[model samples]
Target chain A: MQKHFITLLFTLSLTGLNFANAYEMETTFHGVLDLRATVTDSLTGNYTQGGYGKFALNDGESFTLAQAGGEIALNWDNGLSVHAVANAYKNNGDFKLGLTEGYIKYSGLPNASGYRWQSKLGVFYPKISLENNAYAWASKNTLNSSSLNTWIGEEIRVLGNEITLTRLGRINKDPFDLSLTVSAFVNNDPAGSMLSWHGWTISNRQTLYTEKIQLPYFKARMQGYDLYEQASSSDPFLEVDDRVGGHVRAEIKFHKKGAISAGYYNNNGKPYIVDNGQYAWKTRFTHIDLTWLLPQGIVLTSQLLHGDTLMQSPLKTDVVNNDYTNGYIALSKRIKAHRITSRIERFNVKDNDKTVGDNNTERGKAFTLNYTYRLSKPWFLSTEFTWIDSYRPGRMYTNQPINLTERQLAFAARYFY
Target chain B: MFNKLPIQIKFLFISFFIIFAPSFVANATNTLTVNVVDTNQKPLENMVVYVEPIGHKVTLKNTNTLEIGQANKAFIPYISVMQLGSKVKFNNQDNITHHIYSPVGDNKFSVKIRSGQEVIKNDFNEAGEVSMGCNIHDWMSGYMLIVDTPFFAKSDKNGNTEMVIDKSGQYKVVVWHPQMTDINNRITKTINLNSAMAVTMQLSKPMDEIPSQQNEDDFDFLSDY
Candidate 1:
């Protein structure tokens, strides 16, 4: 809606630039209204593993969720500002909320040698690692650093509209920040094989960002998307909104907390998928990511994600390719109140044109451990352990060959404000 | 140089060093600036905030405060508050080889950190928030928030905070957390320290909500810890 009628004509031109008598404009606001609860148990995994803390964090057994959310603020005495965070959840069945930040900020700008320039806009989270933008209880791995979620966003996650450019270095000097973006959403393009996106077409909506001059530390990002859905059958000259496709990502952040992320997806089909009668009423994807930051703060994340879902259409003709490989190598140590964590991950999925069970290929290996204690204003404690090894092979249709293993344990305590 | 020295010996050495460095001993010093926010005003980035310098008197020449580390198996500045006996210097920088400790409280301290090793004195005078782990890494964790007030700060990255109360009263404005359910807890507020302005604590819930590196203990679903 033209960004909501140009933000109501810029707040009615700021009340028509000081409407006569009555004075207006005074601001200061704060934030937070959070709530959470989690439980899971999967020794051999299910619910698509990938995370829920790897097969439900073993030892006992459970799968639970109770969550709430908050964050709404505004402050301006000059430097101006805005803040947001909205959360919601329900999973055992499925449910969620929206937005973490809607953006609109400024640090006054105007300055040279003193250096500092900040600006934001709608949808936030992503500057990569340190757990990106923490707060799931300050994270120690609720399982997210799977190598940038298979290339830039398996769960590095996303929203849209971003513009950031900063250069403020002085710890004797060495802090540089740069960001350029163009975002629009309603994603999961799947190369125009549309299985989702009923929001009245935009071809599954996706615009992407990160492309502009980069300096001091060098950074880059580019995401592409394409979707189209309209079907009468599986094929009939494939009617996907005038043929569209999406996928492309590149990420880089050097030295100080190193980072290297890469992505390339070519999903040729997916429109709200549903038809697990042996794999996919949908599935077509490819993802990759990698990271490192260990100078006494351990963070050696890794990922080589690869996914493929195809039951039909190589583009209304010759087709064949179904692969999924996920990788992992993560280490974390967030100070204060003690915390110790460990992880080792691996997943491999296959069906390079079928040669066994459900068309063949599936592998999983995961191991983890954690402990935390922060006592001083309210005691906080945590403990955990996990292990899983899964494999599947046999039966082009039925020779049956599958094995699953699991072990998990977890503990938690909190009372924050 | 050869052309200057004679002007009354450079005006008597810049007027005897700007008029005798405060009479050489009468002594006088001043400096204060603190800023922070949260509660929606945002601007609280790293957040650690502290304050408690009422009566103990001057004893800090600043040596880059204090920070220690160990990696992966825990400890790396998750939280470290000082002043009250100060002195902390633990280092391992990780190459695998740790057995850190803190058996009892009030300043217990233990050791066993290999790999590029290092471990300085260890003299905490007690305020609270001391915890460390590593029975062979066991997912090593850390926290040392020992404070006694002289004022404190930690909230940047947009969360904001400012403190410099040399002698302010009603000293019970609490907001400390290791996860805070009770640790001699406090949440009172009265702060009237003459104001230069700064005080915010925006956190919906961030005291280790758990998500920074995964592996949150694997599963017990908390019926007991």
Candidate 2:
């Protein structure tokens, strides 16, 4: 499915690019090409091991690996649009195309609505993002060191829905910007909860989502982006393991070029959850984020996320005793045709639900720095150096903590038509 | 359901949102005249003016490097376009060098322009808007917006600019300002203009009030310049 989607998108994107939007092969491109990879050098003996799975914590082996992928969006004349994502690796994730954003939407509402009102019902992205989908480097702030079992309210979250609402604020000068989106959906695949890890979730369901709120935001030259407001509900009839709950998050950018983002979210710990209904479990999770954009394009992005877990707890089984703190500094510089990016991630994790073979608390560190040179018009090459450390406080490799630190080096080349 | 309220009240308040919403805008087609002032009623230079089409085909991309010439100590064309898939270039047209980069919007970028230097381009893949600042000069600031649609436009000194929508389509037309009245969030209305119509939108702002750029916390900008 992913391959087919990519083929269609690649053809359309290249065609669009070649003909421009003129279709006469003028190629008015309305697409995007994102290909990213890293190659690194080893520092510790056989320590570089990382992938996604219940057993990705490899015996801690050192090796070199790299991957790349991106998406292309094509807009047709009759309101039909298609977006396809492609990756260089097998099951690399993010490779599917559907009407998630294809619909014949009209601009002017019935006029009985407010100003700045417009919406699409066929398919589209929900109005949910707080840096998660904002910046490429900023998205993995918590991923660098997160344990394999932590569950977030909106972790790995997305759904198909019909929507309607408004587009508020001025692109350049509007101080108080706002957007109100209301969507309804049915028979969604339930697989994640604010109670499990990335790929965790129940399956097959129907629900409604009548989300309504006035999100007023601000963007000043001195400050980046600041949002101040509140939201009350999730989708009207959206089924989430057959449970509904309130969700919200907000943040403010300080004068010192640093930003603080925080939000409190909840979900009906539907007993059917986890225990398959034998145990009615309710859940709630809270996440706080602070990003200090220090000097020299170096970003110190940190986040503290804790949430309720369990089919039932003595107090709030949903009590989020599992706190995940992530800190990382990302520095990048573009010199000539070579772009250099260096980033190091340190994680502090503590969990209440201790799974098998897993210590209650663990500290891990990963350092990555790379350089890419756009070798030619449609090609680019990149190489990176990385270090991954899984700390075991008392154990020792020689006199050092038995903790494991794997080092790796990788290189990749890409082509964009 | 509410088709029978008094016609006067309906026109004055109730149906106001519905009546002028899908059509009339702050353009020449309307009666409102917006005089964008800097608290001083002084026409602010480099202030960007965006118009959200009611319903239309908008294009988005990332382009690093917005070029704003520096002659004196001030940044020229203070207001400019910050598209997706792109970057901004701060050229030191002045005799001396300038350490520039927005602490906010342009946080992903920074550099020192030596009299006539400029950065090639940076990345801005995702969509939305942001602000840029100069670390060396706290007072020097600029705005950068990442939009998914080409239906948006900026205004000139007379707070006027001809908004162009390539062909024909539906659009959520909104004219906004950093200091627009709290009656609501700036001014947004729906509009449908066929290609070449050249519709007139008379956008306006209330008197006695203008947002300030001083309260900014030395860097992070949540509002405007």
For every model shown, the clashing-pair count is 99, 115
lDDT of 2: 0.38
| Deviation in Å, model 1, residue A260 alpha carbon | 21
lDDT (CA) for every model shown?
A: 0.41, 0.38
C-alpha lDDT of candidate 1 relative to the true structure: 0.41
State the number of backbone clashes in model 1: 99
Model 2, A267: alpha-carbon shift in Å?
A: 5.0
- The residue-level lDDT of candidate 1 at A405 comes to 56
Q: What lDDT tens digits, residue by residue, belong to model 1 across residues A1-417?
A: 225324633553453344312432233222222222334444222222211122312224444332333444444334344554455434444444544334444443323332334444444433333332333212334332332232332212233333433332211123222223223322222321111110001000011222110111001101221111222112111213222333444454443455565555442334334231111223434444555667876666665655554544324321224555656666767676676767677766555652111223556677666666665433456565556665644211222224645554555553333
What TM-scores do the predictions have? 0.23, 0.41
Error of 2 at B125 (Å): 38
Question: Best DockQ goes to which candidate?
Answer: 2
